[model samples]
Target: MKSLLKALKRCAVAGAAALAVVSLQPVSSAQAAPAPVVGGTRAAQGEFPFMVRLSMGCGGALYTQQIVLTAAHCVGRTGANTSITATAGVVDLQSSSRIQVRSTYVYRAPGYNGDGKDWALIKLAQPINLPTLKIATTTQYNTGTFTVAGWGAASEGGSQQRYLLKATVPFVSDATCRSYSGYGGLIANEEICAGYTAGGVDTCQGDSGGPMFRRDSANQWIQVGIVSWGIGCARPNAPGVYTEVSTFASAIASAAAGL
Candidate 1:
């Protein structure tokens, strides 16, 4: 996994411009926008309230009463101070519960290269009263579907969602995703890939660190992945990859315990 991650970092550095060009295609010319999945009904109620929009320029999920989980890259390239805020039970961005961040804890894996172990926890000044989320423990993939919700751009190069948006996507196998040239072998054990390889139903820019959740036997949602990185919004053979929340369950539990 370490070697694979190193290779991925190297690839990201070497092909940064090419990757950016291929992933962030302009969608402004299109006459019609893909209809966003509506809230309520099938959508999980009160779930997005715990979902946080980080002031560090990324999105995240609130797992506990006082803990907000997000991507490590959102902290910025240099090891510098950054401010973050958390909002709870938010349905409409204009009129949602908001809270100021008290502290932040970033857990970079030992000898971490970059983007791996890309997870962080934000401590809120006050505890939220929403339902706590669960992290998956099984290695099951491509067996079930999951949902990804965030306040990200709808198109490749478009404006971020004013309100929260969500879409359901099927999980793709590592071997299948590994067959791609750009991101094939880079998919690590601590990550999972989803979205349509043909380019649709994906998380775009500003979606980083959002929650990717699957339904359990009881029909309750369990967080499986954290929106990490991808080639683009949705492109052929380029599925959105995320940090497996289950892989960092212990780290999250420990961090939350500290708060």
Candidate 2:
């Protein structure tokens, strides 16, 4: 498979990811500037209360008092592991208001290998009494504005952020995503793309497993995707790819029931 991102090894996967992140950073010697989503800004406290940080190096969202939604690649070598914990209900990770919950169950799609089915549901040992974000139930045009947040790196090859950062990324068609270099035939229905062709705002490492949300007609936030992979962090022609949440909503409902 084509490599997943920039520091790819730079901002890509590590830990339990069977595939170690491969650096896609252009061999350059200059220091990289700080960026959000790719060009985003710091979010205010409680702005994204649903955002959660996985202790193992990925991002996630609070699905319920006892469940968190994240990426399959983030739950250690297997979802069955019990060492995972999620810090929730805070913008700054170091905040005193944060509630930590150990994962009791981690469920990845039965067919998950690496590429397509990238989502996972984490059952917490206790509930975090906060408002939760809902999942989208149908497919829609991925061509408008969307929001993504994480404690991931602010830029490619940069260190993971200490505070939560957010950015508004425009959705790209599957064709647009596929047209990018290294992504020709890899775009799948279970995935969605969002970003700019100019290399500004985009998700980075540590941002993986975070939520890709949009405001619905009623002006309520609903999760449409889960941060999964990309070719680079906020690079021109490289957009962030996420697990299309709607495609797996049924599966999530079914699997989460067993929790």
Candidate 3:
């Protein structure tokens, strides 16, 4: 049964592209990156107020009272939309204290063909009272250990969780990440990699568009990356890749202002 589950996990992670096309539409040609917590713990109710579970099996963070930051591949182009919903204020999906807001508009990164840029902003129909998450503008906070949270699968090829799960992954240098077999010259400046090379903790399926963040000098949580893609769920030498939030910080700010 254990071996069978592992096989299922690999199949699920490998078929991410097809899954994206069928349910998440307009995904990039590159491998789709969305996974749940593998080797993570359940988060407390108020641990991450800015964190939200996307109705479309992805994760996101509140950039403003009415704006959310996520992976571009997780949404459609810039336009009016009322279908996407953001659920926040609680870790447990079954909790009655949860706050729900629908998306009003989506602004995917310009020229986001899945080659490089993978970040997006979503304007909400109404503002939520939750504390918004701050994004990193410089590379200062791009290093070290980062926290990733989502309702994605608790194991590779596993089912999505009812409660938010979180795990910490160390930042893997671009040079080291690029050294991987399948990642040669593919790790762009707009992307960042994080995970254990030994293969343990990571973001698995259902965790797409989630925040990869850490506390700043001011002891405040600031987002540095967005869960984008990877080779597999949690395999050695195959770390989870994320959209380097700092690389497109300026553009994101401008877009958010316009939204």
RMSD of each: 7.9, 6.5, 8.7
Deviation from native of the Cα of residue 3 in model 2, angstroms: 5.2
**Each prediction's TM-score against the native?**
0.76, 0.86, 0.85
Residue 39, candidate 1: Cα error in Å is 13
Residue-wise C-alpha lDDT for candidate 1, range 1-259, written one tens digit per residue? 4334323221121010011101112222231223341111122446545577665445777777767777765554322233556555764555644444544444433334455676766666667777767777666532357777766665665555556666765566677667765665454777777655554566776777777886777887778887777765565666677787777788778766865
In angstroms, the error of model 3 at 163 is 0.5
Model 2 C-alpha lDDT per residue in residues 1-259, reported as the tens digit of each score: 6443423722234221110111113212232322433526777888878888888888888877788899877664445657888888777777887888888778877777677788888888878988888898888524356788777777666676667777776667777678888777554778877766665677777788888887877888889888887876777787777888998999888888888
Model 3 off-target regions past 4 Å?
1-39
Which 10 successive residues of model 2 have the least lDDT summed? 15-24
lDDT score, candidate 2: 0.71
The alpha-carbon lDDT assigned to residue 60 of candidate 1 equals 71
Better of 1 and 3 by lDDT: 3
Model 3, 108-169: lDDT tens per residue?
Answer: 99998765688888899999999999999999887866888888776666777888877776
